[model samples]
Target: MDGDKSLFAWVVENYKDGHLICDDQSGETADFLHISASSRTLSFIHVKKSGSSSEQRKISASAHEVVIGQAVKNLIWMDFTALRTRLESPPIEEPACWNSGVKGSDRSAFLAAFDRRDATSRTEIIIVQPHVREAHYKHLHENGLDHEQISEDTLRLHLLEGLLNAARSTTTSVGADLFIIGSSD
Candidate 1:
């Protein structure tokens, strides 16, 4: 599989069971959104590729900034009402891409999964990078992010603890949660 497909598959597999994953194909939406029916969690993931030279390795500072910007942009667009409307009437050109089967039965299940009102109660923004390093984090801290903007929840920095934990889980290479910004409430 190509890089994009591989990354999407990895995300679906790593999210564990009881999660409904869908591709946010609209250019206006994030790359993907994962909804946990049991937990009532809604998470948006923005997958970004590092510069060609940095592929499979640490991301460049500029690339990292771009990823963060996209995350913030998606978060701002993640209005619960808007999301519900979009899900209910998904774009005609954009079809649902469940992690599992794509049969008629799957379509019924997908619609049911998205029909719940609880899924949009909580929100998370995850930036999936190929890899990351301590310097990258430090750089983001020093320059990429604005504390004032974050405090206002404009970028959802408060919900980033999970992403930080994920990043810290591996020292040698950052996994899925490279840069996460999340809603506090």
Candidate 2:
């Protein structure tokens, strides 16, 4: 597929500052993502199963919301070789923690390193981590979900509740919900 200009450039230019939520079972690997960022740079947030870390950048969630709004976008993983060809910049794969044979080289370590570099350089290696994967139940969980065609309504509600819980403690006011719960009548 052809790449988007604004989103692609934003993702390419600001990799280090993008949030990265490496779930407990997440594998050690890098990704090229299209996270919604208002600024030219990104503010990354990684919420692991055990706990989580603050965004690598100095921007506020409200600040980010103002610019990005509620636009749904795509974030896919592209290998190092492809980046070199597209950006016209020579490939420079510095020793990354995940494959570096270092301890705790999962999502957490990369987030930490990205945070440090993002702060110092104001720009570093691009790394994007989306909060939740957008897929239907059957598509998302593969064979884990019920075989019967699950309703999209059911899936959206389930994901929304989980997302709310995940974003509750976030400093960025990103999660926007427009629903009301009923009391036991």
Best by TM-score: 1
Off by over 4 Å in 2: 1-40, 45-94, 97-156, 165-169, 173-185
Per-residue lDDT, model 2, residue 89, is 24
Per-residue accuracy of model 2 over 1-185 as CA lDDT, tens digit each: 13653433333333333332222122222233112222323222221211112222211223222112221111121232342233232133332222132222234444443334322232212212222223422243564345487555445545545543434323223332222111111
State the C-alpha lDDT per candidate: 0.50, 0.29
Compared with the true structure, the alpha-carbon lDDT of candidate 1 equals 0.50
Q: Residue by residue across 48-70, what tens digits does model 1's lDDT show?
A: 65344342233334445565666
Poorest stretch of ten by lDDT in candidate 1: 170-179
Report model 2's TM-score to 2 decimal places.
0.21
Models 1 onward score TM values of 0.56, 0.21
Which candidate has the top score in lDDT? 1
**lDDT, residue 119, candidate 2:** 28
TM-score of 1: 0.56
Q: What would you estimate as the lDDT of candidate 2? A: 0.29
